[model samples]
Target: MPIINLNGPKLSTAKKKELVKRFTEVASEVIELPEEAIIVEINEMPPENVGVGGELLSEKEDK
Candidate 1:
């Protein structure tokens, strides 16, 4: 089974729906395995959970 893990900012409902559709379509073309064997997981986190350089995204210094 193929598992795809996606991590990024929280996505809108529409974007989530789109991702599900697109992921299935794209994975089918690239992986020769059975369509049912593919698994896609999307993990969304708040800006506070992300970091850049030495600081959390929510604590980054102003540009």
Candidate 2:
């Protein structure tokens, strides 16, 4: 089994589904694995819990 872990801000259900589909397709092609054998885990975090450039996402957005 191949596992692909993705961590980022929260996303809508449609977006998540799209990502999963695309990721599975690429993984299957690159790794020579079946789509059923590829696992994609999306870990969502709030803006407060995610940061960029030494600032929290939420804080940066306020600027």
Candidate 3:
């Protein structure tokens, strides 16, 4: 089984579905694996939980 892990900000259900479909399609094509055998796992986090350049993402948005 091939697992595709994606970690990033949260998204709407529609966007998540699109990402999973697209990722699975491409990965299956390139890796020669069945679409059903490819797994796409998404990990979403709030902006407050993420930091960039020593500043939290939520703080940056407020700036």
Candidate 4:
């Protein structure tokens, strides 16, 4: 089985479902594997758990 792990901020259930579906479809086509043979994992990270330039993501301003 092929595994795809994605780590990022938290997301909605709908978005997660969409991502899994899209990823499975594309991966299946490119790798010639069945959708069921591919595994997609999503790791949701809190802003405080992520950092940027020595600062926590929660403390950084969007510029």
Best by TM-score: 3
lDDT string for model 1 (1-63, tens) is: 678788988899999888877887788778866668777889997778888787787776344
lDDT at 28, model 2:
100
Clashing pairs in 2: none
Candidate 3 lDDT over 1-63, as tens digits, reads 799999899899999999999999999999998999999999998999999999999999998
- My TM-score estimates for the predictions, one after another, are 0.77, 0.91, 0.92, 0.89
Clashing residue pairs in candidate 3, if any? none
- Identify the runs in model 2 with alpha carbons over 4 angstroms from their true place: none
Give the total clashing residue pairs for model 2: 0
lDDT of 1 at 21: 74
Lowest lDDT sum, 10 consecutive residues, model 3, at: 1-10
Q: Model 2 compared with the native: what TM-score?
A: 0.91
Task: Write candidate 2's Cα lDDT for 1-63 as tens digits.
Answer: 799999988899999999999999999999998999999999998899988888999999788
How far residue 3's Cα lies from its native spot in candidate 4, in Å, is 0.6
- Give the alpha carbon lDDT tens digit for every residue of 1-63 in model 4: 789999999999999999999999999999998999999999999898999889988888553
